[model samples]
Each structure stands twice: as structure tokens, then as C-alpha cells.
Target: MIGRYIWEISELRRSHHGLTLNELNERWERSSLYDGREIIRKTWYSHREQIASQLGIIIECDKRTNRYYIAYEDTIGRPDIQNWLLNSFAVGNMLMQGKDLKGRISYERIPSGYDYLTDIIEAMRENRIISISYQSYWKDEPSEFELMPYALKVFKQRWYLVGANVAFEGIRIYGLDRIKNIEITQQKFKMPKSFDVEELFEPYYGVSLVDGEVEKVRIKVYDNQAKYFRSLKLHESQEEIKTTPEYSIFEYHIKPTFEFEQELLSHGESVEVLEPAYLRERIKKRLEWSLEHYK
Candidate 1:
């Protein structure tokens, strides 16, 4: 409820008029929120205001209208701030519910499974380069890589760090789970002011940015599989190319990396790569390889 309250206050600040208790209650009544607490009391409002103030969300009550208005600069734009508020709200809500979260929800994500998150984030925030000992599945042993931490992204329930590796003099992606140890460097580096993470990764699907040519990948999903693909888009660049009774063709303008192929193959025999001859052959070879294993 606190998260919702923070969100509500931030949103209400966009308007000239503030939100009154009656208006707020109307919203709460329509949704499952706090025990429907009457926040009209001065003390209740003051207490919440204090918490919001700490987060840089200034709140003021108008004497004439008897309503609450968000007065401070917006803190909602910052992901770090939002994350803190979300954690605070979730913990507060769980306490209010007086129930353990066992089976209540399945996060199914292990982003927090690693211990170096704080260290990496701190390095990124401070514009400090970091050295990490990483072991990749494809590699025989752990290797040391000095990376300028740029941004972190989550793909398929795993956390990945995207940055420039000073050691290799190239940009690379590292899986947090594979990270053995991280050392924050004393030498500071300048992150390009024009660096845009989204643009850097626009050509790739998922976290794997293969040092290969980008392609317009087309997949032909047969029958029921097409519906599932439509609901859960294969990629942001996914587009319906053509549909026929036998199959429906969808296209994604992306880097058809190993991860992308794995995702397609995971859908079993329902999907077929059609546009690129290489991807099609790759998939065929994989299926043949699977048969050989069984034989």
C-alpha cells in the first residue's frame, strides 16, 4: 500500500488539484489496498508525509481544500529510488498482511543469488572500472576481465552486466551468476555522456550480443503455436509477415544469436526458421544432432 501510496502521490502531483481523502478512499475501495485506513487524520497524513519526504517526495496539505499535494521534485524517475520504494512497500505490505509469502508468489528469479550486485552497482554509480573473475560455460577456466560497468539487464530470470572491457578493448556482456569475484578499481573512467543502452542492444534479442551479422529472422509457427507466439512476442522486432493455413510467418529484425536460437528450439517442433537459410540449416542440424544423440 505504501508503494501504491507513493505512486499515487507522485501521479497526483501531475495535476493542479490535489487528492482528498474521499477521492483517495474511492480509489482504495475499488481496489484491494490497505485495511482501508482513514488517512484524513492529521497524524496519519503527517506520518506518511515524513516517509515520502525522506524519499524526496514532498507532500503538502492545502488548508482551503484539505487535500494532499505532492510538492517536491519527482523521485519516481530514478530506478534506484523506485526500487527502494518498491522494497519498502512490499516489506510493509507483508507485515500488514501478517502472512509469510510461502507459496503466495513464485518469483522464479535469482538475480539476487549473487553477492557482487552491490559492488558492481557501486562501481557503476561511481564511474569506477571493475575487474571481475568470470567463468563462462564455453570456457575451460575462469578469466579476469576489467569492465567499465555501464548497465545491468535481466534476461530469462538471469542478471547480466553490459559494459566495455578495457582488457579486451571491446564491449561485452557477463552473466552475474558466472561472476566469481569482483574488484572495484581505483582508476576512474568516464562513461560516454551519449551512451544509450537501449540503442546499443537494439539489434540483439535477449542478453547475448553475438559478434556476428544481424539478420531479419523469420519464423513460421504452425497452428496453435502461432497464437502463443502472438501472445508472448518472440522479440520486440517481431512482426507478422504472412499467415497461411499451414503456418503463420513472423519476422524479427535482430541478431540471431545462440540465445535466440535456443529460445526458438525450446518451442519444440512447432516453430520453423524460414527467412534466413543459415538459421534454417542451423536449426535442422540441431534437430539432427538431437536424433543422433538418441540413436
Candidate 2:
């Protein structure tokens, strides 16, 4: 509760408020941080440090004035960490308020029926190749493939493994749920010295097919959704070049992929493909074809 309360105060207004043991008691109201009337100094800071370390974030306090603030920047884009912290805070809040969210709270839904997460992680850690029995939805039967597991990512609530397929030249992404069996090989492989996870996935959205030249893709987000784009960017390359009360124009430098196109389509009528005329035409044709199905 001390950590959660302190984080909230620091986040809303940093220097304007200096939080001390008394202020924490006033906020949390008769928590474990105090012994009835006195603030327990050692235990309070110990809990704060524990929460900060777990979240991989820093919360700074000035001893001279006892004011607290978050010293870290660049927190907006990381949905995973943000979701975790928000859930943690919610649970703490409910407990302190003498209420249980229980049925009122629905957890983030992760697609089930995948079991190869640990095996792939260990293979990546050991720099070893793994043989997997994978059955893609498009195929009739399961196929065996050996892959040098590089990185694992969670997208749309499903886990995916990205690495070099032995039969394929470049890295390929395989869905973990589609993988039936995992056999870690004794064979060791060297990860390329220049293979950076971020750089590899930077030009694409979600798990990509890894085709085509990278383009400075641009799009126009109309109506209320523009505010959401400003807060949670579509990609690291996303830039908001124009804005008005009616609409906002966003530019992105991304390799056009099925995943990226589908993402844009999800926003529906609120979004339009603005630049890269070819991409705009592609979306227009797709929408026309979609309308045909209803007819």
C-alpha cells in the first residue's frame, strides 16, 4: 500500500507534494506501514524498494524535502509493463479499501492451448537448436521443423517464437500454440553478433512475414481515436505530424505487412491510409471486397 500510494502521488504531481510517513498514513489510512500511531520507517522503504525492483522502474525521493518522483522516462509505449503495474495497483487499492473486485474484474485473456514456452526459452538461453512439430492452420498436417530460437514474443494474447528456421535462410516466426512438440537438440549454434531483437522487429508490426522493402507508411486517424494513437503509438516509428479538432494525421515508417494492414483495419472507419498510394489502394480494394461479401 505504501509503494502504491507513493507511486500514485509521485505520478500525479511530483515536486508539489512532499510525502512523509504522516502523509502516507493519511492517504493509506491505518495500513501496516505504521504501528497504530507511529510510522514504521524501515518497513515502509523496504516495501517501496521491493515493488520498484519488481516493476523494473525507479522511484526517487529527495531526502532534504522528502518529495518523491519517478526519475525514469519513456514509459508510454511499453504496454506489458504498464498493464502489470496497473493490475498490481488495482489489487492493492481494492485490498486497502476493504473491497474485493472478484467478479467485477476480468483478467486479460491470453489464448490458451500452448505448452512450448519454457522449452523455447531454454533453447534460446543455451544457444541451441530445437525441433518442433508445427501444424499451421493453412496446412493439412503437422510438419517438423528445426529452428534456432532467437526471441519469444506475446502478441494478441498468443505466444510466438522468432528464430532461424533450418530450412529457411532468414528468421521466421512460429506460433507456440501451433507447435505440438519441442525437442531441444544437442547441436549448438551461434547467434549472429549483430542480431538485435529490437532492430529485427522494428520495421514490422507484431509477428511479420518479413517481406518487402521498408516504407515510410502514413495514415490518417479520424475522429476520437486520434487521441488514443497519441497516447499508445502504433509503432516506435510513429509520428504525429498534424492535428485538428476533426482529425489527426500520423506517419509511420514500417514495412507493410498483413499484420500491419489488419491492425489498421481494426480501427475501421476512423482510419484511412494517407500516403504510400499503393497501400491506400490496397486497403480500398480490400474494403470493397469485404462489402461484396455482405451483398
Candidate maximizing TM-score: 1
The estimated TM-scores of all candidates read: 0.71, 0.70
Provide C-alpha RMSD values for all models, in order. Answer: 5.6, 5.6
Error of 2 at 50 (Å): 11
User: 41, model 1: CA deviation in Å?
Assistant: 6.8
The C-alpha stretches of model 2 lying farther than 4 A from their native spots are 1-100, 112-114
Write model 1 residue lDDT over 1-295, tens digit each, in one string: 3555554554354457887768766665654444656555675567566667555566677989988775545465455555555555555544444444456654444644358888987898899999889998999999986889998877775778989989677678888999999999998999999887777888877887677766888888998889898899878888988988888999998988788889999998899888699889999999999999998
- Cα displacement (angstroms), candidate 2, residue 178, comes to 1.4
lDDT to native, each model: 0.75, 0.74
